[model samples]
Target: MKGLLVLLICMLTATSVFAGKADTVKLRQHLIAITGTSQPRNHQHTAALDEVATYIKKEFEKLQGQVQEQVYTVAGKEYRNIILSMGPADAPRLIVGAHYDVCGDQPGADDNASGVAGLLELARLLHNHRLPFRIDLVAYTLEEPPYFRTEHMGSYVHARSLKEQQAEVKGMISLEMIGNFKDEKGTQRYPLAPMKLFYGSRGNYIAVVQRFGNGSFGRSFLRNYKNNANIPVKSLRAPAFVTGVDFSDHLNYWHFGFDALMITDTSFYRNSNYHQPTDTIYTLDFRRMARVVDAVYTSILNL
Candidate 1:
């Protein structure tokens, strides 16, 4: 029965890929809670920001991570970035981050609450695990307009500070809109027409996107991520002209010359509810989202 034993071992290995706190139900509840937070347009709400920041900080503490806040101000308004660290203090750290703010007044469930949920799930699964490098889970503020792409963005500030500290940064992984998925044909669109033929017209996969000349980082991570993932994952290396590649917090890391990639569902390319009041809990696929979180864990361990 040698063949039978081999098959059994293979099944067990696959099952272990998603073991522990990568629970889809729990992930759904977390996303729902985040989406329910207040979303105020045109103005940054310090109260809402503090509420999420506190929640993130406490969650990390429960996992025994040392939590820190990077507080700053823009135009006389205050903001904060919730930071948590695991592994050795002297090692070069790997970053896992997601922005928590919404665009204007939208519920922003898919735009980012989902990404934050993924980050939390990762923190939970990675507990007690040892790695060669440190891992930092960062919850950022103001990734959306009118602050997007500006130096005021929480990610930009964090990246700059890390550079100044001369912190050994391995790289940054930014999760953005990882909840939306589609199976029907013609559901996906691209900024460039030719991409449709190369990538396909179905919005049914998670994307690991890196800028040109950085294929080594994104491709390796994407390969490791897809190795154990049950869901579809597409990896791409393109220039900044390719829309959505630099759409999230990862762009800041790239600006600082750090190798970074975005893990996403393609955002507005697939989700019609993007940045709209209609973007809510019901529009996302929590199961697939959980799979993405698990993949991130697996990729980090493999890296």
Candidate 2:
């Protein structure tokens, strides 16, 4: 009995170590450094964008993974989307993306810096781990407005190229504004009156949102992530015409008939600092963000 107890303890400790939390401090610092400054529109912070991309590339290369850059010029301004691939590159691929750009004078910590933080952490967690299918981790630019719904959307460019080349993409997951959580009631809001009945008022749960036709993939992804992370998750499927439905970079992939979902905190619905200067790193819930990243890692592996 004593030996059996010791073995169980060891196993539990190993599991805990493997499922350790994402580095909140590192994530916070990354966001603070980028959005803390005035990354103005049309004059976007090119230096900061390059810095974050370099950091991601170095981290992935440290694990002996292959990293590539896809560069495109938008309105005479050059921008590059960083891509990191693990496992067999020729196999069916799952693309995970988050835009690393900010809009206006706001430090877009929750607006999108949080999403980038999650993406970087996800890449770190799955760095050395092998998977059955190829995973392409991307950091896109120009997800914010003025370019959001237009053809200038960075995701639109990337996804369109994939379609043009006939790349076999199995599915895509977009991480957007996923670092904030609140356990208090009356903290969450919805676009439609009926949605309030389906979801709770507390802002503690992560949301899996999709359009009407994409509900099946949304539910399946939500179920898998819920089972893996054991974290609170809220799901909603509605027509894209609804307000705040096409709020993330994922909407671009959906335009191309790809099965995609947005993992978010509902952005402006719950986060008070959505597009303001107050969207700093201090306001984010890093613990939950780490769990979400872990769940994503597991979901991709299973897919």
Candidate 3:
């Protein structure tokens, strides 16, 4: 645990060249606070997830955007998905989201705290940028098991509401686990042999995962990102049923027939600490994490 503390402190020490000094400060503070586990249970003092949403909403509001809360009840308890939007309200929308809940009591730094950090950092960068469509930075809840893949998932509720309203969604971008990275040979693992052959065995790359037959957004975004970002990027467009393909908040959007993709570090494929108590901020690479956020920013700007 002492070693872990040292490593987590290193996360704060990184001078993020990609995110700029000011944005890096916001990312560090938010990531540290978000990963401080309160160990709340679903039916008990469930303020843990609520706290994450509140912090994210406050940060977004600080950047001069209005925050909205979509409240839904599950098992008689209220859960919220916090949102902030920019650009024309009636235009087609681009949803960027990350779930803030861990699998259990662990800190879950890489499992999702890193992703939320990316989400927050992106929100900061997009504060003044304008696009033809609206962009929403959403902080979702209840993404981990025994709630994962269930309709009660915060993302499911949010996605269903969009479908019900018949909102014209351009695409959804879900940040799953975007921090952890490794450069050593054989450091990365894949669900199948062919994927390893296609995407490579190095775990140092961030990937865009899309279901086959989905819209061309993922590929176009990947192409733009490849041109402007300094980090390595790979893309996977496979059967939706493939293991690890439809694993995050993006899955809910896919289910609603909206094009969606996940940006991630491949989760358990490269991080052994996933879902474990050791999955603290120590294991994350925030500099590279910042690059991932910058890559997404560049991609969206070019799109």
Give the number of the best model, judged by TM-score.
1
Q: Assess candidate 3 and give its TM-score to the true structure.
A: 0.90
lDDT of 1: 0.86
- lDDT of every model, 2 decimals: 0.86, 0.79, 0.84
Q: Rank the candidates by lDDT, best first.
A: 1, 3, 2
Question: How accurate locally is residue 275 in candidate 1, as Cα lDDT from 0 to 100?
Answer: 85
Residue 213 in candidate 1, Cα distance off native in Å = 1.2
Tell me the tens digit of each residue's lDDT in model 1 across 1-303: 999999999999877754653788877877767776655422367777687778878788899667899999899988989988999988999899999888887778888989998998899889778788899999999889989999999999999998998898888899999999999999999888998988999999998888887646666787798897878888878898777879999999988888899999999999999888899889988888988888888788898
Superposed by TM-score, candidate 1 places the C-alpha of residue 217 at a distance from the truth, in angstroms, of 2.7
- Local lDDT at 16 for model 3: 45
Per-candidate TM equals 0.92, 0.90, 0.90
Lowest-sum lDDT 10-residue window in model 3: 14-23
Give the C-alpha lDDT of model 2. 0.79
- Superposed model 1: Cα runs more than 4 Å off: 1-18, 38-43
Per-residue lDDT value at 81 in model 2: 80
